[model samples]
Target chain A: MSQMRLSFLLPLVAFGILALVGGMALYGTLSGSRDPTQLPSVFVDKPAPQTNLPRLVQTGSTTGNNVSVTMFQGKPVLVNFFASWCAPCRAEAPALEMLSKRVAILGIAYKDRSEDTTAFLQQYGNPFQAIGMDADGRTGIEWGVYGVPETYLLDSNGVVKLRHAGPLTRGVLETTIFPALEALGS
Target chain B: MMIATGLWRTHILIGLVLLNMAIGLVFISATTTPAYAITAEEMLANPVLEERARNLSKQLRCLVCQNQSIDDSDADLARDLRREVRSQIAAGTSDGAIIDQLRAKYGDYVLLNPPLDQATLFLWLSPLGFILLGGLIVMMARRQRGAAIATELDAAERARIEKMLASRDSENRPKT
Candidate 1:
């Protein structure tokens, strides 16, 4: 082959290969085995982030209770990010309520109003042991919450066991969340 | 009876038209969505800090939006992130330190351009690896193609053919 032909063919071949690989990755993301919603967290198996959210008005503990990392010590806790405005939170409200009967679920009202959250919980059933008001969403960011309705299963050591995105569906709870909690022990 | 049947058909036709219109309206409303861009009013007061925030925002992915950078996404989380970036910049935090802090909290996925780490080593190098492999394959193909075209006449083969031709000519000359 001529030198010119080789030079022209090189980049073309590289581009073709790159395109094929990129297309496969795109396809894998869209329709294949990879779940796009779950951004694999580094916080898993690491200590739960430091949080200092004010107590929700409903908690009314008089102790000035704030949700903090220390709360997860010596016990597995389910920390969930939720908002009244989130449609998926509404769907999972009952599921969370049912799950709460078995384990401690800590709720952080992500960037939501206290009255709205109170109404939402009253309308659906209050499932959280302690509800923290993440008014500015800074606490949510600290916990690496991407969106409302994300739940993290924490182990006794305050290390995150499993982080789940989206609403807590019955099937997901049964399969992943429950198993993780079960492994963490009561 | 004929008049009644015609009226009944008209009613059914109108129902169908309304049904189609409703579906068309829903589709329009669903698909005519516009993407949200972060507002200019969210800019930092210091031009230098604002420039840094802008650049950093482009580098940071909107976790909730999944694909778009924080600068491009309209999600509340993205807005919060832009505010966070600006605040960090204003706080005199270095750009690398801010990005590292975000990566620590959100994992490597938070960065629009992920750094080459153990987990992302393959992801970063795969493009170069593919290019090299592609070059090798093209080179091999070129060599094979050249050899295939040259098969009809090599120096030794051409010399052998010439000798054979010379012998045949001498043999056919009636031993002159």
Candidate 2:
């Protein structure tokens, strides 16, 4: 081939290679694996974290009620993390209320004011046995809460049996939580 | 001359078109689908649980992409990370533990919003530093140019140049 032809062809070939490599690199970077492989549940096969939260029945009460890990003992319990401001929490409330009748339900109000939580529960129809106000979100962090509306299913022994990250819908309650509860025998 | 100019104009037009097309393609690719896509199956076996898992996944950054969450990244490594998150959640791991494990494996870069740390100080400050450096260089160059223009010739050199110019002008004048 002539020098001029070769020069023209060289750039076209270079551009082709550049496009291929660049495209693949972008796709690789964008499509790479990000699965959480190493993060182990501190609560898995372990007892629930201890919490002391004020009962929201009274106003201006700084003193909190003691809730031991044993509260989740014997009967299977579903511990839900929620906040009044979270929209997904509102969406999941009805499904959670329905699940409450089937299994014991406990609520942890993450980083929410007592009054707001009480008002939310009242509005949404409180289905929890004991509602713990996690005003600081320290308890939520311990339980591995990324956001509101995370649910954890505990076995009769208070060991964490399953965890759901987002809002609990009827499908999940019936398919995953119910099956696990059934396997645990009630 | 007109023909040559016309040919040159044609070449320039072609070059401009090619450059514009390349730029357009780049913009299109950038604005398209997110870098990652977290499937419902990868997030949760139960259809009801998928939405919750997806929400959490969207908040957590992919270690490789740094800017994109695992839910938006489509990289192979991101897929693996998504699967890993699913497995952990399936195994009943908490959210804190999952984030901690990612931080441990990939360093703080895994977090979309990396914690304020010494290593990341440059990432935050480099743009400002570059702007300052460019301004300083421009100022220094302007100062140098101003100084060159303001520089005065010594008395002896000025007189020598004037004499040379006078001699040249006299030589160039016609004898009258």
Best by TM-score: 1
Model 1 misplacement above 4 A: A1-33, A59-65, B1-36, B152-176
Error of 1 at B174 (Å): 19
Q: Each candidate's DockQ score against the native complex? A: 0.32, 0.02
Candidate closest to the true structure, highest DockQ: 1
In the range A1-186, model 2's lDDT, one tens digit per residue, is 233454577679879989998888777656532224223344666666665665555352435565444776788888888888888998988888888888888888887887788778778878888777777665665565556778888888778888876787776677678899888887
Query: Using Cα atoms with residue i matched to residue i, what is each candidate's TM-score against the true structure?
Result: 0.74, 0.47
Model 2 lDDT per residue over B40-107, tens place = 45657676556555665776776445578878888644666667666677788877787787665444
Residue A58's lDDT within candidate 1 is 68
Model 2 regions lying over 4 Å from their true place: A1-42, A58-62, B10-176
TM-score (0 to 1) for chain A, all models? 0.80, 0.73
